[model samples]
Target: MENENWKNIRVPRVSSIEKCVAEFDITQLDVPSGRFRIRIYENTNGKFMGFTNLKIKNLFDGYPEGGVGNGNSITEALEDTIKNFMENLSENRILNDSDFIFVNYNEF
Candidate 1:
């Protein structure tokens, strides 16, 4: 099967009060694989000024496939996202690459 076109994926808009700090597109190479979008947001709410939120969306469906992470820095959020994604994949028994597509993360 041909690789899904990640470029056509549309992400949700951030709230006017929050600012998007960074964004990335990662490709999943297994069953249910597709292009995923990672977005880091800086909260501007007075009570949450120093907090950040990281969200990972499955571009194929524009939904939270990897869940959300909260942290004080981007690195922490990314680590959290990785952990969540692994757990989600394992829970669904998508453990091998033999029946799906394969692509290096850096190739994007």
Candidate 2:
């Protein structure tokens, strides 16, 4: 996959991402309790290097345990995070919602 040629994809700026949320399809994830929200963000830092970063947060707890995934595109970043989350689950390293990176929704 690494050898495959890639094309340029435009991503929303971090500062204006909230306004452009509709541009990207919102993905709903099934959790132990309920659904989770997957929000994609343009990695301003990765912009120079041509990569996007994603953050996954739990709906009930507003925790982003999945961490930031850097990739050539939004989809790649999201997939990486999901894979990591599943791996953690299989290892039983993740115990609860608190295991994720907590964030204040009001602050976003």
The CA lDDT of each predicted structure is 0.46, 0.41
- Angstrom error of the Cα, residue 41, model 2: value is 1.7
Candidate 2 C-alpha lDDT tens digits along 18-43: 22121132233434334334455453
Of candidate 2, the 10-residue stretch with the lowest lDDT total is 16-25
Task: Assess the local accuracy of residue 49 in candidate 2 as a C-alpha lDDT between 0 and 100.
Answer: 15
Candidate 1, residues 12-72: lDDT per residue as tens digits?
8943355556665656654344555556655543111111122334436545333456667
Q: What lDDT, from 0 to 1, does candidate 1 have?
A: 0.46
Per-candidate count of clashing residue pairs (backbone under 3 Å):
0, 2
| Residue 33 local lDDT, model 1 | 47
For model 2 the TM-score comes to 0.42
